[model samples]
Target: MNYTLHQLHIFVKITQTKSITKASEELHLTQPAVSIQLKNFQDQFEIPLTEVIGRQLYVTDFGREIAIAAEKILAEVHAINYKTQAYKGQLSGKLKLSVVSTGKYVIPYFLSDFLKKHQSIELILDVTNKTKVIESMEKNEVDFAFVSVLPEKLQVEGIELMPNKLYLIGSEKIDNNLNESPNSILEELPIIYREEGSGTRYTMEKFISLHQLNVKKKMELTSNEAVKQAVVAGLGYSIMPLIGIKNELLNGELVIIPVKGFPLSSIWNLIWLKNKGFSPVATAFLAHVKQEKTKIINEKFGWYLDYIAK
Candidate 1:
């Protein structure tokens, strides 16, 4: 006859996530069902407990106060549940993770292997670009994300992932008048670029500016594959992770441009909200990633053959 525990659980998720859709995904409920519950909860209140500001929903002062109380309530309930489950000695849950595009290449292999080790868990993944990944993290859209850029004012925690070296690659198909000289490489080839807000793009621009080179951007793309494909098609030259283009480099579809200091590298990092409590599954998954990072990098990509015949 009173509010159900399910409602409180869903409502608490809503407060933490600040979006109906994110809460629905985390709680495995339909959007309409979440909306109905939200409306019911709001109707019970004397004043609206939240507001929308610039596409993000915020808990009002009163709502914030109540949500803090709700957090304590939920924490206690979960602690009890966790202790009971620990007594049973079972680990079964879903890990919800989102990642940036470049991470799409690296994170999955690491995650899959972790899943193999922890057979009782499931990995729910959403692979997106850096901008969306950061935005979603700020809004509590995902439990965790892998990123290269850590923005200011985002309430998040970041742990450094392994550093991947960057390289400037030119299509063997394009630079017919090729030279091993870095200056010549910069002087001759058109620069292909990644999309705006990309960490790779930022790094590339900084390096280019630092080196004081004239840029002739010929093409731009969002996907790493597109950038590589553009380079391979002889459309232009580009900079990217050396890890991602190993095959192309080995096969001679792409050539590592011999610019004195053309390519630059940076570290990637793991991200999660500072404010949100980790679900049991998410916690286990984070631990797994931390443990497996070295193995992931060291695992020789043997099939990593230069597939293209030059």
Candidate 2:
């Protein structure tokens, strides 16, 4: 019944990664050393913990239970360690955050000052599609998540940061004035769309449905950059956030199509699970964002503000 925390940690990592080699790599231990520890751990329990099949490691049912218990123990240990540092008035830890793809353009700008101010904090930012970001958030894989569309079912604590404005963009070579009406554009122009599960695509669909607009979708692209490029090549038009294409808009490479009920607006939000506790670093970043969002947006996103105003 006596097992070291180090042994338990290695066991948990092995179970999660399903590879002793990977666990060793992550733990910065030699492969043979990890194998010895794992063997010793199994001997203490006198229970087969893992089975090898097709050259891949798989944890048994008993191993799964032990792994879950080990994870909880490790989490408590980590909390104690963090509390010790906090008591010493030291704020030093890694902050893990995930954001929707479009957030890459906006989140960094908001985080820059905070990162510079808190030199002790290490930031791990995962920029991915909306679906993956939401999945990560729901699984509590990240400390914070930035999204334009809020998940209705998750019990979350969130703050609205800024407006995300979506506009129909086309190449400057085309006459944007001609397709001011949805019906005219529906019949005459081809529309480029983002891939499924995109926040932009979701918002665009809602807008289309609300207005009873049926447009011809010419292509479905995986990324905002791809959609923008397709539109710039005169292949079709796309609805994208203004934040992502400020430079193109300013340079006149793309023109916003003046369509009715245009510039579909949504809110940017920072969220975390309601029951999850926030570390000091997370709390600090939350405060920084809450205080600086408006000022930063007005300063860095002045073009968007001005455009929306007009």
RMSD after CA superposition, every candidate = 6.9, 4.9
Candidate 2 residue pairs in clash (backbone atoms < 3 Å): none
> What lDDT score belongs to each candidate, Candidate 1 first?
0.74, 0.86
Q: List, residue by residue over 45-124, the lDDT tens digit for candidate 2.
A: 87789999999999999999999999999889877876776677877677999999999988898889998877667688
The candidate scoring highest on TM-score is 2
Candidate 2 stretches with Cα past 4 Å from truth are: 1-88, 176-180
In each prediction, how many residue pairs overlap at the backbone (N, C-alpha, C within less than 3 A)? 1, 0
Top model by lDDT, which number?
A: 2
Given candidate 1, what's the lDDT at residue 107? 77
> Candidate 2: deviation at residue 296, Å?
1.9
Model 2 lowest lDDT segment of ten: 172-181
- Runs off by more than 4 Å, candidate 1: 1-89, 173-184, 300-310
